[model samples]
Target: AVANVCGFIASTLHRGIGLIHFPTTLLAQCDASISHKQAVNAPHGKNLVGSYYAPIRIIVDTDVLQTLEDWLLPDGMGEIVKHALCQDVDLLTYLEEYDGALNDPVFLDYIVRRTIELKCEVIDIDPKENKEAVVLIYGHTLGHPIESISHRMGTACCLSHGQAVAIGCVIAARVAFLMGLAEESIIERTEQICAKYDLPYLIPADQSVDRIMSKLPFNKTWTKEGTMMALIERPGKVFNFDGHFKCPVDDATIRRAVEQTMAPFGTIIKGSGSSGALRKNKLSNGDLASSTITTPIGSPMEKPGEGWAVSAGGSCPKGDC
Candidate 1:
């Protein structure tokens, strides 16, 4: 499906025809739109063939969502979850208050407005993802690995992109908490939002932990080191602490965290077992410990002049950089 869609777009570009994407599926709307456009496909995974080209325009008509299925609504909700966590806390509150009634004209309008505004804000600052725009990938780094490996295992429908990302955000937050960049409350808050929307909160224990971790090194934004974890400073901001944490944390810690977050709901993989499913592997029962992450060399500490200084002191609402 994706290849055909991309082939059509590529053909049009070759013929000098401008491309405009009007994604209707919740999966297409959030995940496919960006993944198809930005991330290129690698030999090991999907979406390896692509370029960064801005669409002439994106029209996310809420009315179109009226015919969506129950599952599709949550798929789109995952994007809302991402936007809320990284960019707008108000949107999180709104979703928490209203139980995903995207069919409502007023609610759909609100989501479309906020989603567009958030994307535009990201573009205005760094459309090309050159500088701090890395914040837009808050949940994607770890999430993609999960999706890729799942597909590799022949369980393509196992998890959606947003579901993988919804799980990844909590994992990233847990890493951030370990680094002291965020508090436990923040992690809990993230969980609360995910739970409200029924997003996947953990990975299946039977998943190939090794294969999933392998995908980390392929990140274009990653440094030479395999370590890549985004540090959450505040809303509308994320520090891509590439090479900050250890490459693969101990199996014990990974299992504990993955299982703990997932216990509330059923096992990470719900429904019937697939034909090519692997045997169940268990996470070791032991203490999971992570120390504080330090600043990389040449990347100076947060002194007066470090990072992008938008303005000095009380200039911006969130306080000056």
Candidate 2:
């Protein structure tokens, strides 16, 4: 948080160059690298304080990802899946056909480049995340809450941001299906892709449905009138119910979607126990203990000044940089 704030301040003060080295795939493909956004988490919500600050240039080193543990690979795939669903059908096909070769540097480079390009296109259209750019947040409406709550409960290692977004994709697909916007195949494909990457599609048994639902209002995507979510009708196509790209989704629909998404994994009985399919291959406590969180470096902003400042090396004061 301090690094990003420092970077944001430096960019505002001078013409800075932001060099981001993505150790995890998620940081490479998602908000950390390409977008003109900087933010820090607050007590109320994630990314509660932020501003639009695009970088002069972004450098993605695929070799850096080679050092990531196997479990960490899915974090990047979550964003890849999001891009494929919203903008690139070919990318979706690639994921389905080459699920086994996900770790290959060549394949990883291609995915990262393509994902970055897709994001760049969106940023060009809506640099401030106001209109068309909102589509980029296809699965994040629910994904953010799951991530926030998981981190708060100290289960973030068990449920990483990428994993939560993967689950969010499934839930969004289900919601689209329920609204008669998306075909049944889309939902199946969404779940299949998540499973292919060993990412979570169902909400965990421990998370509270009510709590997740309550966080909807606080989402950054919401407007003054109502909650706006980016729902999809098919791969590479976003659903636009009323001509506005950001569609308004009701609480009842979101609740139903959450319930149905959780139903397949298990039935949440009152206060006692869940009955149904037991969670298989759950992450061991040791694995969770060893898990680490990586925050993306903020992009630099173009301000008139003399020199450039880079925030690299040394420990972050907040211990979360």
Candidate 3:
């Protein structure tokens, strides 16, 4: 889908036409939003038609999520899970433990800000995929098939993109373990976290491996060698390539593994019973997390390592970092 869009935009520009990308899916915000990748499906595989064309501007407005289906939330979460798997334990913990707080403005603000910071960091490090910045695809090699199948089948009984990706994460984790890139614990942790958010760890039932494989060649990441799957070994460490195993299984193994990791719920994290009590104990301001780690309510810029770290070891004040 992304590759095709890019091709259309590029081809049109060559012939004197204009193209604009407005991504409503959750995956769009995290990965697809970063660059120009358009794709379309064909008999051989998923994205058969595509090209790269940078957009004039990429706009992300949280308000758009308001009208989206509840299932779509997890679709976006695939990207979030990928980001968390890469650089932020805080994010993983938050999603696994305090995801209920997401409804709170304060919590959402922190998440939004953190996401922006992470994206900026990645773009800064590698505006072009000339380096390891490509690690962003940690769970995507498997994820693309899930999404392609879901999209190809349409919305009726198919998994949404985010759900497919969530399941893909599980598949990647298992693959990681098989290749010795990641430990069993990480796979369990990934599954546990997804469960906390009500995301399915297993692939959708009845999904055919051959069906998904049929779409693989068209994927943007596909190469002359074969499909490449990115597996997470540890936070910030990703391993990618095509044929790493001595005894690689067929598509059936892939389908079965995906199913084994499926979760019963969808993706929105549920509030624990204490959620009401926490809301009831609201502070005067919206700095709930910050309020927990304070020191003497000290004056602004008190000293180094203090709430307000001022130079010269003098109190600078509290308002600043």
Candidate 4:
């Protein structure tokens, strides 16, 4: 937070002023530190008011991470996993086989450096997020809403940004397979990685389908006709074969993805219908026939879980409502 505040201030005060980033948190070190997006939250929403400013140089030390709380360490890994899923097959393998904490010098140094390289691989191509860079946003489509709703819903536990995005990645992979654009391995591998890290891949019963869907920031993802998403055909590659990074998808698919994600172990392969049989694989320890998620196209879905659903600080009260 200080880096963003100071970085943004310095950028606006004088263009010639330069800053070097010494990010302390795992999230900052892995993702936000390298990111040129510097922003401050408005009274209404986060990152709503700010500028994109790059640091002059970023210096990271695995030693700094020792002071961080255990819960916070996974925050950066959420993004690291996203990068691997989108760009690097080897990084994905590295995460799968390794078992270590942020204090493990070997894992810490390699991942912190690897994440930076993977991110730059894309951001360098489209620095301003005009295109391509959005691959980094793979899980955030639903993750942002999940993160916001977790805190606002008065749940006993709030999901960290990393945890929420980890769930979102699982849902995205499922979304691709549901749409018949990607193979089932995408979903399986993503879910496996999250489990390997002990990250929360299942939505808590408190986080309802309605609240999450309502809060999704689809201003960039939605089009006039329907919604679009940055889905991957497989690990280390995006499913944007149409020459556009933003792939078109039906509205029902996005909703179903949210619904399935909300339900515990909810991944039903192939709509049991007349079009054709899909390559189906039920999630481990998941019952294909029992989940309330069993619904046909356009049917009334699961209601929001019973709880107090507060608007996120009245973000949609008047102007944007």
Work out candidate 1's RMSD over C-alphas. 16.0
Model 2, poorest ten-residue lDDT window? 271-280
Candidate 1: residue 12 lDDT (0-100) = 53
Runs of candidate 4 exceeding 4 Å displacement: 14-17, 42-45, 263-321
lDDT of 1 by residue, 1-321 (tens): 352365346545666355566777655555455422444446666455555555555556667777876666766677778877777778877887895455676876677667766766766667655555555667776777666554432221356666778777887777666656677877788878877777766664334445555566676545653344454755444654453322323434433444344332123354112211321211122221111111112322232111111222212111111
Which residue pairs show backbone clashes in model 2?
Answer: none
* lDDT of candidate model 1 versus the reference: 0.55
What lDDT does candidate 4 reach at residue 188?
79
Model 1 ranges with Cα > 4 A deviation: 1-8, 11-16, 30-43, 99-102, 154-157, 240-268, 271-321
- Show the colliding residue pairs in model 4: none
How would you order the candidates by TM-score, starting with the best? Answer: 4, 2, 1, 3
Of the two candidates 2 and 4, the one with more favorable TM-score, higher being better, is 4
Cα error, candidate 4, residue 283 (Å): 38
Instruction: Compose the digit string of candidate 3's lDDT tens values, residues 72-190.
Output: 55556766776787667678777777746333446544555576567667656665443455656556666666555543311112454555566677787776676666788888888
Consecutive 10-residue window with the lowest summed lDDT within model 3: 301-310
Q: Give stretches of model 3 more than 4 Å off.
A: 1-11, 14-26, 101-103, 123-130, 151-156, 213-215, 220-226, 240-321
Predicted structure 2, TM vs. truth: 0.76
Best by TM-score: 4
Distance from true location, Cα of 268 in model 4, Å: 22
Superpose all Cα atoms of candidate 3 onto the true structure and report the RMSD in Å to 1 decimal: 20.0
- TM per prediction: 0.70, 0.76, 0.64, 0.78
**Candidate lDDT (C-alpha), each:** 0.55, 0.66, 0.54, 0.68
Which model scores highest in lDDT?
4
User: Which lDDT tens digits does candidate 4 get at residues 240-259?
Assistant: 74677777666678778777
- Please give the distance, in angstroms, between residue 4's alpha carbon in candidate 2 and its true position after superposition: 5.2
